[model samples]
Target: MHGQPPNILFILIDDLGAVDLASFGSTFYATPNLDRLAERGLVFTDAYASCPVCSPTRGSLLTGRYPARIGLTDWIDFGGRIQPARGKLVDVPYIRELPRTEVTSASLLRGRGYSTWHVGKWHLGFEETYPEQHGFNVNIGGGYLGAPGPGGYFSPFDIPNLPPGSPGQYLPEVLTDEAINLIRNRGDNPFFLNMCFYLVHTPIEAPADRVAKWEARVRELGLDRRTALVEGEFFPMEHKRHLRVTRRILQSDPVYAAMVESMDENVGRLLDTLEEEGIADDTLVVFTSDNGGLSTSESSPTCNNPYAEGKGWMYEGGTRVPMIAAWPGRIPAGSRTAEPVCSIDLFPTWLAQAGIPVPDRLLIDGEDLSPVLFEGAALERDALFWHYPHYGNQGGTPGSSIRSGDWKLIEFYEDHRLELYNLAEDIGEVHNLAEEEPEHTRALHQRLKEWRGSVAARIPTPNPNWQE
Candidate 1:
């Protein structure tokens, strides 16, 4: 087994923002476990999900390629084609599954002799389209990432006929238990267990006991438990009655808070399981989220702002997320790296750490980040790129962008508009420097143009019924 590669415990959360963590100056909550993870490994302040939403972000993370390269630009609609809202985007339905032929981290790691396993949200798809086809032994919960995890959260068995024992198991708990079991029964060779979670996302439900605890907290604060995801401001989609039912859950609803706290508690369980198995020192654990928080849907009407809109936006509030990597005796404890990194980097980085060479023929868009994590090396790429042409429910502008050094350029598609922000000076992207610095804007633009041309992204087809 090529001298024992360090086991990887990749815990990817769903839509937890970077600013939400204490290490990133989040005053609202204290994530001691996340903070501790950052202390043990490298915490990249500039890390981002490739896309601002789930499916696309995950696609890039797995393939190390731009989402456009593979016809997966929008979230795949679980049910069918989106009928479209008049005057909006073409009524293109989401792709229910990731296309075949895409290479993944599992395929790469499995080749290197690491026992690979995936437990948790398999939003990518099911059966042939699931994690197994991509190269990992699978134990998928909330099998389809299309729905907000488990309708009520406590124990959601969305799958029509999921066995008896499954109904009583919460998705997060199910995943955590499976991961712990894997660690307990590890073979001599190091493993790579991708523990992707469907946490704190939606279907905001929790165990009755935990919810009761949350209810008591709300009562102490003199608030009602019928307004889930409502802290202040408004619920734009609460007009729908079915959604209104789920909305009754309080922002202070002990249930929702307990759901989040329970995810954390399970994280603690997985950590303890690692130490208990006597492999804690050699394991490389990463804690991160797929994208920014979700805003609203059939089951939820929440938004992660103060920074901006929730997910599906081309802004910092949507793209920025917490990224903590921990490896004992290798990575520094209580350390943080400000260099920007993306989930796609996992493919190449894991390959490098395992002493496996990434194939030059792979057309990989991400660079190996092991050097930076273990040796405090600078970000390998001169820039990172993002392209999302479709409009999502969230009030976000569709755009494409490139980040080279401190120069960042974002081009909006609605009105052929462009906005440039020197992230070094303004991380929130408030000022429009495109008019002021045409030279910098143009340079980034040309680079993007050339990149798009190379990727050969799908161009809009001629409308057969065009009146013009």
Candidate 2:
């Protein structure tokens, strides 16, 4: 075994909801690989992505800073400015890429002689801000495009940094091959492999055989039920641009189920590789997602119900995600914790695990969870914050939120309105106690505001062009 400095394999899934896998409580989608990993690791029931979307949370995972503090508050749509038709406000300007100056965890680890590599979705920034520029010695399929590019989960992905694969090759499967190759060639250097799978994201396409299996399973289980119409905000897409209401509440889509299962298989493959290499105990494998499920638009693939709303909304369904950390003898096997943790914490935690010093010049918003993972200790902090000043494609409005203990408060910038909920009692976030508990609301709001001031969090201003 590799003694104290274990190799790090961070597997980040895009748009995989907290409840997407069997380990997380979803019956429709089967994720045996992830479930096995959970059984051998510390499962976090209250892990969160720094943001509800992809790019920002990805940045947080890398830099250990909140997206708001880093100025990459929204998903980087380098294509152009996304102006919502008939919307009340225009999205505020945001940093289009991960700044070069920021010291990412990969960079820090690489400095300590960890051979760093990144595969799959990079979405953090454009050409100059890619994984290689930051720290990764090898970058495969990491690019600006969020989803698997044009070919959509198949060959001819046209993804930058990736060589062309055989026709009809599955994206996730191919990415896993790349990761396996890296592991096989890693030699004696302790490595850090960030396997960012572009699975269960967009295009909602999967191998025909896998789809057929899920389709049969769905029918056998009598899972095909009428879709429910959840009460959510109504917005405009201008003609056929967007759906007025979010509908797909049931996770019965055969295509999405297939994608999830395929991703799971690759996860299992990677683990099998580790075991074959006799490095399973010497490797610290962490698995989680950048954000919650995508239930609102773009095929309305999966649902994150019981927590209210899905990807893009400030609700738990949007930010809450599955997190598992395993290091054979270090992290307790089959252990579970309810201590709240977020994407940012991985930065400091990984550094702490590698015995690397946190850069004194860099400001970090995330705390190390090594104590929790290794010793079952609790973090002293009471609250976590989120600031997203831009509208989400999934119909979430611009807002900022603070979850303090059991009570959570969300302040909408459009009308300066506040909504509060006791998450312990109302995990669905259905009942608002803003008026019922004025003092609690005020204190949470004050904290949220103070956090914004401290991080220089950006807030969207009134749009003069909108009509009431």
Candidate 3:
């Protein structure tokens, strides 16, 4: 709508659930800023991350290709402590770094004269493959690290790129300050700011004052009296078989709520900065998450009820995430769509917005979402697919899933078991219709298999070390 190209601000939160924000559905977390953003923009109810983990989905966001196609199918582990668990099937090896040969959204935008800046988490690769190498003009607080370093979300972050802060400065606030500085100092060129927050992830520490406030709120709401976590079956992975699956039943974790509030406050600050700098109308702000919430393990901070399981499974709760896009004049205000978009769409969407054509001889799996975002039209696609052939750190088995229209079919690699569900009828996926509807199951499974073959997806092999 502006004479010049619209500035792009993409805010990606790590491990945030489908309904983590108040605007989405959460009753415990306060996200007034995000709620206001939803009120002013289009809310995508059925948006999904390309993968259930962090690195793969983040790579897809930049490359416009599925993780399987790019050969980076899991979260890249820098410390080597969070190795993929093995049991019946050993996890397949994957690309450790995002290959520099691939064309990324940042690279394309920067070539077109846009000032691209990446702030916060850059777990895609190591020093050889960083944001600066991937087309960003400035990279802050980004490196091989996924979550905040040894210091957690507080000061002395241990992130090499980010400078030292005060003794107790929060990570999110510091990242936001850097982003605001970038926007304020930006000249005539349109900019692309990729703001990735490490909040609501592991090390769920928060400001003491905010944590205290939520602790009182939890008491006032009487949530402390209800059941919070439930013990379930043993983990499928061998490394954690001794531990049973622990799921958070309630969304009353005070520390996690505090982190959510801190993230919301920073988001508010970024949006306010845009308004204050008189660039609010000329910017397109998109907010989303890498994957679903951490609901089934590692303290099980938040619950993604109504959707079963969470991050690292092939369930709706694992991949389904919150997506909001607000452009003052382009995207309609207070609009909602269930068109089923994925993280891969961001690359092509950004290119289209910048009026740049996709390079010849390059393959892009994602479709351009300009019509859907700007014209309120529906996406024309057969289905969405996911392949995670490795046991999750949580309690998930190796599997690949396909969702066509409302029908979703998941095929487990370990036993070749098929589980089908009509998402329209069972959003929780509690009722498996694989046996009930043989025809639909067969059709969807066949399509999933064919798609995997086309993408050259690797399958896990039988592990020789398994005893049981």
Candidate 4:
């Protein structure tokens, strides 16, 4: 632990909920392997993703900068404009690729002589800007697409970076097998492997047996569509076009449950591989999600109950994600913390762990959590902020927010309305306290404004063609 740099095994899951795993209070989704992972690592109870979407949060993790600062504010859609039928404003143009100029954690680690590898989803950019351009020595499965191919999660994937497997082979299993091969083949140099899984995302497909198992479990629990239905409002983003965003109140989708199970099983496979290679004690492992569960669009698979909303809103469920870190003899076993941390913190934390000094020139928004990980110390930061200026497919409008202590404030750009909630008292964000708590709301709003100005954040502009 002192002389040699520890090998890093980072597992990032796409569209996973804060409560999707049994370790995170999910009674329905069976995830024993991830639960075992929690038992051996440090669980950050209030961990949050930078943005409640895919590309922005992923950018935050790799760059240690806020999405606004990096100019990757929205999910990459290959230059598509969101022209709602009767919208008041148009979305600000965002960068479609992770800039090659910005130095990444992979590059930093690779510069130090570590072997860096990336496997699975690389939705950050087009094919030319894949992980290999960012610092990975080996790249697999990462391509221009954010999700599985048109053929779905099974074999014969249409993705270019990944080769076809047998007829019914699963994507997560294939990715894990590649990771295991890397772990076993590495000679003596320490490695940094980013294993991002495409499970639990849209076009949810699973093995027939796994789907049947969950279907039977749902029937056994007497859960039906009526009992699972949860209401969600698509706030007025335009005049008349309102997309229905209904979420299953419980984690009851047989297909989604099967996907979760598959991810868990493959996680077990990677852990088993580490133990088999006799490097389990010397490796640092991380498990987290790119965003919250997809409970707003496409099938509305799993719900993030008690947190409010999911995937594309500025609620606890959408932004809050599950994070666990394990390094034998470094992070205490069965450790847990309630301090709020976000995805931007990982780069600095990992660099600190490897004894590398963060370069002074970079504008890193994240703080090192090494103290909290090793000594359970409280973070000394004052607040965290988020700015999403585009109408999301999952019912969220253009807005900016700030979370300070127990109070959170959101300022809607469409009408300049403010909503305040005391998260400690109301985690679901049911009661708006903006009117009752004027001074507190004003303070948070001012800070959000200041942050936006500091980052030179892009703002949506009013459309002249609106008839309203």
Q: Evaluated with TM-score, which candidate comes out highest?
A: 3
True lDDT of residue 214, candidate 1: 65
Give the Cα lDDT of each candidate.
0.69, 0.88, 0.92, 0.87
Model 4, 291: alpha-carbon shift in Å?
A: 1.0
Clashing pairs in 1: 39-333, 39-334, 214-254, 226-248, 227-248, 227-249, 227-250, 228-249, 228-250
**Per-prediction TM-score to the true structure, in the order listed:** 0.86, 0.97, 0.99, 0.97
Candidate 2 ranges with C-alpha deviation above 4 Å: 81-86, 228-233, 236-242
**Per-residue alpha-carbon lDDT of model 1 for 1-468, expressed as tens digits?**
135678988888876765666677654343676666666678788888888878877877778877777667777666544423112233233455676788888888888788888877667766668777788854545356555434544454554213324566776777677778888888886798888777776666678787787677767766663444533233212122122222212234355466667767788788888888888888888888888766544344333444445577787767878788888888888787888888788888788778888776688888888778877888647888887765555545457888888778887765567888887888767888999999998999889877777766543322243221
Looking at model 1, report the run of 10 residues with the lowest lDDT sum: 236-245
Model 3 lDDT tens row, 1-468: 337878999999999999899888998899999999999999999999999989999999999999999999988887766565688998988998899998999999999999999999999888889999999999999999878989899997798699978899999999999999999999999999999998878999998999999999999999999999999999887888899999998899999999999999999999999999999999999999999999999999999998899998899989999999999887899999989999999998999889889998789899999988998898888799999988888788889999999999999999999999998989999999999999999999999999999999999999888987
Model 1 residue 416 distance off true place after TM-score fit, in angstroms: 1.1
Task: Tell me the tens digit of each residue's lDDT in model 4 across 1-468.
Answer: 277889999999999999998888888999999899899989988899999889999989998999999999888876354433125777787888899988899999999989999999989888668999999999999987878978789898887688888888888889999888998998888999999998878898999998999899898988754477656665445632455667767778999999999999999999999999999998999999988887766778998988888888888888899899998888999999988899999999879767788999998999999888889998899899998888877777788889999889998888899999999899999999999999999889989999999999988888787655
User: Candidate 3: lDDT of 255?
Assistant: 96
Instruction: Please report how far candidate 2 places residue 463 from its true position, in Å.
Output: 1.4
The Cα RMSD of model 4 versus the native structure comes to: 1.8
- 84, model 1: CA deviation in Å? 5.8
Best by lDDT: 3
lDDT of 2 by residue, 1-468 (tens): 225688999999999998998988997888888899999999999999999999999999999999989999988877774643225655677888999998999998999989999999999888999999999999999999988888788887789999878988998989999999999999888999999999878888988998999889888877776653454455632322335656577888889999898989999999999999999999999999999899887767888877787898888998999999998988999999999999999999889888888978989989999788988989998999999887888888888999988889999877788999998999999999999999999999999999999999877766676654
* Residue 273, candidate 2: alpha-carbon lDDT: 100
Q: How many backbone overlaps does candidate 3 show?
A: 0
